[model samples]
Target chain A: MSVRVVVRTFSELCITVGAVIVLFVVYVLFWTGVKADTAMDDQIAQLEEQWAKGSASAGPGDPGSARGPGAAAPKAVAYEDGRPFAVMYIPRLGFTWNKPVLEGTRTKTLKKGLGHYASTARLGEPGNFAVAGHRRTYGDPFKDFPRLRPGDPVVLTDGTSWFTYRIDTRPYRTLPDDTAVVDPVPEKSGYTREGRYLTLTTCDPEWGHSHRLIVWAHLDETQPVEAGKPKALRR
Target chain B: MYGFIWRHLPGNTWIKALISLVLVLATVYVLFQYVFPWAEPLLPFNDVTVDNQ
Candidate 1:
């Protein structure tokens, strides 16, 4: 090929590659969020449908029992992998901000919504109930995690009961290998004994995962579904 | 490069535009379906867990 043709062809190839790179960025940042939002909505809708049908197998006890003296103990629901068992609502984030809590912490599970650590204690249980969510992409369920403060409520519902947790500690940074943050009695949160706790974890620095940002909360109260709504959820 | 592609094609402007659109779409489809999936494991996008290593 002639010199002019060669230069022109080389420039054209560079432009094509640049366009592809931009497209890939768009796919990762924009397209993934759109797809994840739809997936999360569908997952929430499915969970609501199951709850409406009263088909959710929430442990062994009768789910109709109300919270009071002599009421039956709330059994920990047996959660299946990739299935959503609860809906988490963070009023501090937004009035309408909610996400489905899936069972496992795999990439596919987190993409749908927040992923509950399988080994951690269940919601409202007398242990550390931990959850993980994406910080930057895939709908970014915890994108505003740093905005949470002490006394903020992290409420969750399992179709039959509402569990509200009050944030006691702000965002604490730790390494990705530090699994103790999700322990039944978390070591770094200043709690000496076991109690009903909730831990929210996400990637740090908005877009990087070199470390984790953790927020520790204590379960404050529980209300039955027959109760219209919790005080914390009231606008 | 787009100019070169236009010159090499034997169609009018409308036909050239259609052909260019198709080529871009085909390239994007291949990248998303094959290239991105193959490259996802190597990327650090999904390693945000605090699990015990």
Candidate 2:
């Protein structure tokens, strides 16, 4: 081949090789990210189990316990499917994922557990107990979150404590700011009610977050820890 | 003509393919098993406090 032709061919080959390497890197990054997420789920589950037991045994009055005044209650244990960790369930969405919510609804927690809004409502209260999670990433734990119809059950079990709530009105329109969903009252009206409410938040689209989707539920009942099966086995 | 020390570099497609496959497998195994576990502690958010610790 002529030198010019040879150089052109070499340049094309270099570009092709570079493209392949780029594609491989992207694939590996995505795969590793997913693997990391799966590992996180397992870790959260394990942490939930440990936290549940530790909280249960320590009791509210215990010196070294993490339970707050509201955290001391014992109910039927609940665990997620992939790991031996406790999860709060929303029977309406059939939402089952890991628990002991994290701060700011970080991507990692949303990956493992429902990210409870740190500033707002308590676990079992008469106000909104808002939780934010990813709609697609981290196994899409909240993939069905927005589909939760009114009257569907939302359950949260801390291995010894199980709290059930039913889907209520999901009146508010979609928004981007997550904090707005858990505002003291409806963002548009600023209206607050006395009844216990559960708010499930996820990305609007099935696999992405062009908008925010929410499912609202009302408290049905709180069951005792001794009334249900051991959460460890369930996990 | 001088004798070249590193003689023929065999071009074996099968060997190249096998090596690529082995690399991919090793990557998967390490990512899923050892590397993932090792990287768990590096997760900053994993360690948190909900209440008075």
In every candidate, how many clashes are there? 0, 11
Cα lDDT computed for each candidate against the true fold: 0.83, 0.54
Question: Is model 1 an incorrect, acceptable, medium or high docking prediction?
Answer: acceptable
Q: TM-score of chain A for each candidate? A: 0.91, 0.66
Cα deviation at A71, candidate 1, in Å, is 8.4
Residue lDDT tens for model 2, A1-235: 6797677767877975675556445433455457546665666667666876776786754344433223534443432333333366544444244434444455444445556666667666557777766555344556565456666666776454567776666534475644555654544333456556767666655643446666676666665555573332244
DockQ of each: 0.49, 0.08
**Model 2 chain A — which ten-residue stretch has the worst lDDT?**
A76-85
TM-score of each: 0.88, 0.60
Clash-forming residue pairs, model 1: none
Error of 1 at A98 (Å): 0.5
Q: Which candidate is the best by DockQ?
A: 1
Q: List, residue by residue over A1-235, the lDDT tens digit for candidate 1.
A: 7899889889988987898888788877887789789999999999999887664454435545567511324444589999999999999888999999999898878878999999998778778899998887788778888999999999998877788899999899999999999999899998898888999988887877688999999988888876867889998
